[model samples]
Target: MAPTPFESLDDYISLPRIEALALSPDGTQAVLTVAVLKKDATAYERSLWTVPSDGSGAPRRLTRSAKGEAGAAFTARGDILFVSARPDADGEADDESGQLWLLPAGGGEARAVTRLAGGASQIAAVAEAADRLVIGAELLPGADSLEADAKLRALRKEKKVSAILHDAYPVRFWDHDLGPAEPHLLAIDLDTLEDTVAAVVAESDALATAAAAADTETDGATDAPADAGTPYPVTLPRPRDLTPAAHRTVDPDQVAVSPDGATVVASLQISEQRGGRFALVSIDVDSGERTTLFDEGDVDHEAPAMSHDGTRIAYLRSPRSTPEGPADVEVWTAGIDGSSPRRLAAGWDRWPTSLTFDRDDGALIATADSDGRGPVYRIPLDGSAPLQLTSDDFTYTHVAVDRFTGDLVALRSSWIAPPHPVRIGRDGAVAPLASPAPLPAAPATIGEVEATAEDGAPVRAWLLLPEGASDAAPAPLLLWIHGGPLSSWNAWSWRWNPLLAVARGYAVLLPDPALSTGYGLEFIARGWNSWGGKPYTDLMAITDAAVARPDIDETRTAAMGGSFGGYMANWVAGHTDRFRAIVTHASLWALDQFAGTTDSSVYWQRIFTPEAMTEHSPHRFVRDIRTPLLVIHGDRDYRVPIGESLRLWSELAEHHAAADGSTVHRFLYYPDENHWVLKPQHAVVWYQTVFAFLDEQLHGGEWHRPELLG
Candidate 1:
């Protein structure tokens, strides 16, 4: 096939991408969710696709609908279960919320399984009991059954009210309102659906009979179809609330069911004096008795995984952020009975992103951020040295290990590649599976640059050199900083794609400075409370080393970043005039205001006090900035809050007018977008605007605003 045509911005955004991966119980099949842009290109529609675990056959589409499907899993009997917003054929009363659906293993139409009032958000089938499932949904304060909950929702709609009265700490989450209803976990028995179907059939019969009698009296005006198919109206059982009334406000981050379907392990946030704390708790499925398996006052526990034999549970434990220092994470395992807890990989420097137990030897298999890469590791349960597996500059996520074969399947991605499914052998050999949607080739050559920080710490960066960039004709450099402050520039980014810059004939430098992960806790601690001190210096040192390359133009350079990286961009602007221009997106300006207004205020408030804000805030030094700047923010960005950008823009406007009416700074606001520009067209316009600004500043070209803006 004619070497796949060069990918454009439209192609890049339209490419089908895999989000998650899962392996079957018997290790014979694998399922993944592929998100593709809808026809109108407003949003992505995700569908479930399946393939053989052995990589023998092409992937087959499992579920397809306008709303699409997600959170796919294979039951013990090999039937596929997923969540979707597709309307039921019986049409009792369907809402635009997700509902559970089951597709038989023998190849039949998928049937609606659960029709809850608030709709299911996530589902996990019990491995031992195929007919049992645990689902998470939103619930009104006092509503119990689905009918009552629906009635309350209808009443609210009738009253034209959307207000939520919160008597808690957090009333909103990132980019969205969180209340009016609270998230609740419920257990459902699919085997009990037979009796529910019978009851629904009788009700449908009575309704049809009434309609026929009405038609006889009204001269066939209300006639019912005589040969109508049997209505398979599924009345869901009264779901048992796992996170009961007392802890109704507790929102679980992760939940796992035991192999026997008798117990559930969840990471629940419990209120604390200083903000809140996350604890790993086990709940008896039958009695709803909660047991705290692990709760360290100053540490947060998450990602609970139960062993296949149901004898042990493994979880990640990390110290909660404090004003003093950063914390390292470790994998801890405990018996099912909550006894004899021990830490695995005690001396490991890397923090595991996910965890799973080896079915054969019970060895802990985990994926961790290591040396600017997300790699898989096998840590023996006996406390032996952790062995590194799959060494590459790629990030792996959604790992599922085959219980019978010990084979592993995960979605892998790199700086040059989009996420795709891959199979890994026990011996650390990786084999790429046949992707349902193959990705286009890399647009530029990717290499790494290593430099020493001011404090003698090693800083590594990935450099994307545009095609034809050489010593004779050097490319202008764009220093791109990653967000998270705690996250490393290890994986491919769909949002801040370096390839787009490369396509514009610009070399991009992706540097991981102090506070970046995969470098261990001390590295993060180096810049903990003092964001401007060490991290800023580290970034400058790495940029210096990158610009020194023969293929890069040193003088014509620009810097850009988002979130924490955006905060650094603001700081860099005030500190130096080295770059001709800078782009800051969703940045923190006034740290004092940001600390309190941000979505997770409690988390930031723990470290950033009013005193620290005066010293470290970028707004303090805004008057010193002279470089051309582009300020980008989304109104729905609750994490950093749009107030940060608004303040930064106002300060820049005043400073620019005082210096000289230069119009060197501009603001790009997105009313509907969140922290990340998710819409395809919006992302394209974002890159177009950035490139347009860079061309005007770095190349001395006439400024041309993006056409999409008008």
Candidate 2:
């Protein structure tokens, strides 16, 4: 057992993570994004690096590409910007939409600042003192420009037309296909994008004299010329459209801008045919006009932030959750024409996961999920009581703040560290920053574990263990769960990593139960819409307190999860047969056929009630299954929709069949993964088929099969 990199899934998918962190409104540095694993290990590139924010030096890569870079932002003239479909170190026209590059804060070589036909698709909100920015992207709503949205995306890639005319309620999204083009916001400017880089060299010399005057007036070739029909991107300044939906969505992570960049604010969405709510608008970024700054109907106004002396904005609000529970998300703020509004932390019982403004907006850094940690708080806009900030066990995310050293620049991580970059201070301290990827040896030994809940409420988890179990070689547990049954087992998850099942000797757990989420909103109304009740008795009371730990092994238990922990691993394989095997992944067997086929069950149809979503349905306990399950899915999972694991492998073959059409159940199927199995060789064939189905159901061993599951 001497193999590390958590027993090597190609050396833990070749480490190096640090997913994002931008800061630099003169807070003195940060740009982070890191990513790695690309020598054809099938995807994961993201370049940019930098780091400095006063830990005074070390972490410098800064933008290398092969279509790599990520959404790094900064520009108030300290240029950095990012997002990249990369191809144009002066070579342009590489599509697949991701443009907007930049780099230069008095430096060189990062160019391609927006060629965007449907690209520059992200940087939503830069401006902390103007030069302007916004850019969410995706257009084509009756194409009134960007060369008629690149001639309607070159006539849908010249007529191969992958049809998508959904007049709205989520036409696909956990694996793409959301539209024929929608999400807009836009706004750009950057000094009219450096005076349109000489109008992109005079529109590439008038597209070489209109392709030699359409080859001498049709005396020859033509794919569109005479004067050009699809050649638009005059290099920069042409964005301006602010949320003109041909079908909703402007919530580019709830936008922001306005620090004298004359407003952008955002969150938009508003559809409502059967599920859509976010409101808070604003716009005006030089007359794109817009206004409804905080529209209230069923309420949502998402994470906005704004404030940097451009007069307030903040945001969060939430509101729609019903069938008797889960609501309170508050936070608020207002004024930058959103006027008055208020509420900042009014009763803050946590649930933020991100929101900025401090460094003189006088409080509110946010990053919630406490008690299983995610930390970084502060709060303060007069309502008081929040202050936490960084006290350890990681999680925090791209955080930022710094407004000139009031300090922050986040990215933490844990379950033994994976994401890196630090620099916290303003009393929270942290420091660390010098990472082109460093901390990798955790392979297992985490700890924590608690419980109580039989209505006394409390359950928690974590565990891990491996480098040798105790009390006579024990370790075999697993459990796992968590998939936002309102999420929380707190962070560091390169797609669920119990250090590859404690390097394969098992012992996992993780938990957080009763509809998790940093535990509040009455512990998520204790499993709201009763998800198989109290998140399955707060996950069997935290797996019976991690099988009353003596290095665990309650007679070799199992149980896994994916979506709502795969609907609580199909309600713990039809209510416990005391675990020998039961995996799940992308689960949710039948809640009245997943409330109108997922991808948008409108917050479970406004807090459930199709008889409380088929009253805790695990396909109405699939004929009380007695274990041996292992399903897993993907066929392009549109958020728990691979037809809910093909109807839970056709009802585990109509209740565990075995007359000859045998079935100790084991579906697997990836068909080009989604709903997380994200490449890198399908996450090394998903932990080598969940450690070869937990080594043939808890060490009875033989039954290998994962050679690409041939």
Candidate 3:
């Protein structure tokens, strides 16, 4: 058969995507969530799908709903549990919040298991206890029961009160306000709720009618029938709150349950002052008693995983970064009794993103960023040297080891393709699993380039060249900077994709500068507290190396980035006029203003002082910008905030009007988008405007605005 042809931007945006893989305990089955655009092509909706772990058959869709489903996990009994906001079987309207749903192993219609007022946000099944589950839910302050929580929310809505009173540090997260409701851990006994589920399922219509009447009743009591046909008196056990009252305001990153289902461990933010400082705490599932398992003043511990025997716990630890240096991460393991704690892979330079213990608890298998790729590593519990399991240019994430066969399964992707599930053998061989929605073939060829930074440190990057470009006809170069100045360019990104630029006949350069990870700590320290110093120079040096290639056009090059990369693009604008155009998205203009107004103000304030801000801020050098600039921002962004973009556009406009040179400036604003343009159509428009701007600046084409904006 002929290979699938690479088509237009719509084809790229319309491709189906999969994420969040879950393997059954027996390893016979694996479930994943697939996202595809809805019929209207306005947004994407997710659905649950399953595939055989042994690759015996193709993948099949499991559940379908307009409201969508996510967070799939297999219970101890091999049943599938997921979260969705679908309406009840009685045809009632769907709730705005998500609810826990269960699909029996025997094969039947999935039924709602939890009817909490706030609904469920996340869930995890106990490894040992087949009938126990831990769920995360949001609750208003002083509200305990689900009924009371519902009443309070209704009252707030009736009063039209949208204000949130804050007495603590952070008031907002990445894209949403954190205040009015806080997330808490709740323990539910699934065995005890079985009868309640049957009762609700049998008389769903009657229950819906009663619920409607209860909404109007002031007493908050529902009338019930007294006959045999009446629904059994369904009473739900009160769920225990694991987080303490004082720490209820803080949010937990991950939670793991012991094998006996008696204890729960959570990685939570304990300090209100420090930014991203977390500690692991063990909570008694029944008594709600908490014990500090690992707490260090200068280090943060996260990603706790319990052993099957309930004898050991493993987690990742990294020391806080100071203004002078960067810190490396290490894997640490300790007995459940808090004894004989030690660090594994202490000498390894790669940083682990996710970790899971083997079936026998003999070793840990983890995925870490190495060079320009994310590879799997096996570390023994005996403190031996870590073994690299997989070596490829692709990135792997959401790794799961099948207990029955000892085979590893992960979502792997590269610059040439999107993410898909694959089986990794013990010898590091990878085989693609049977996929129902495979990605299209690559339209461009990718290669690597390396250069030496000013400090003699090795800087590497991925270069994507157009298919037919040669010495006779060179492709225009687009130097793209990645976000998370702390992150590596090792993984496939859906937001800042490079394939889009390559499809437009441009050579894209993805560089890992000084602040990028996967290199040692010393490399990161080179740019610590000095965003524009070593990092900027390293980017320039690497770009020079890439553009020197015969197939790249150095005269028609452009630079673009988002977040910290956006800040770098602004810095590049001030430092050099070599690039024909510059695009900055959600960038930081004034370091002082950004530190004060960002979502985590206290955290940034701790790392940067007023003096440091004056030296590193890009706003100070805006007067030196001579290249054409395009600024894009989402009003709902709280991490970098939209104010930075506004200030930048205003200053650039002023500069363009005053300067004698022809340095054009434009701004693309999304009123509803957050840090990311999530909607399918919005993403298409984002790329269209970006390419249009680049074409006008580099190819000498007339400025043509996207029709969507008009």
lDDT tens digits by residue: candidate 3, 336-396: 7667899998888778888888767889999888798888889999989999989888889
Q: What does candidate 1's lDDT look like per residue over 319-399, in tens digits?
A: 877878877787899998679999988888888888888866469889988788899889999999999889877889888
Q: Taking the tens digit of each residue's C-alpha lDDT, what string does model 2 give over 439-556?
A: 8777677878888889998787888888889989988888888887787887888888888788777778788887788867888887788889878887888888888877787999
What TM-score does each of the candidates earn? 0.94, 0.32, 0.93
Error of 2 at 323 (Å): 45
CA lDDT, every model vs. true structure: 0.82, 0.79, 0.81
Better of 1 and 2 by TM-score: 1
Q: Best-fitting candidate, measured by lDDT?
A: 1
User: What is the Å distance of residue 126 in model 1 from its true position?
Assistant: 3.8
- The candidate 2 region of ten consecutive residues with least summed lDDT is 218-227
* Model 3 spans > 4 angstroms off: 1-7, 90-94, 195-238, 244-252, 274-276, 658-663
Q: By lDDT, rank the candidates, best first.
A: 1, 3, 2
**Is candidate 1 or 3 superior in lDDT?**
1
Q: How many pairs collide in each candidate, listed in order? A: 0, 3, 0
Give candidate 1 regions above 4 Å deviation.
1-7, 92-94, 128-130, 195-199, 203-238, 246-252, 658-662
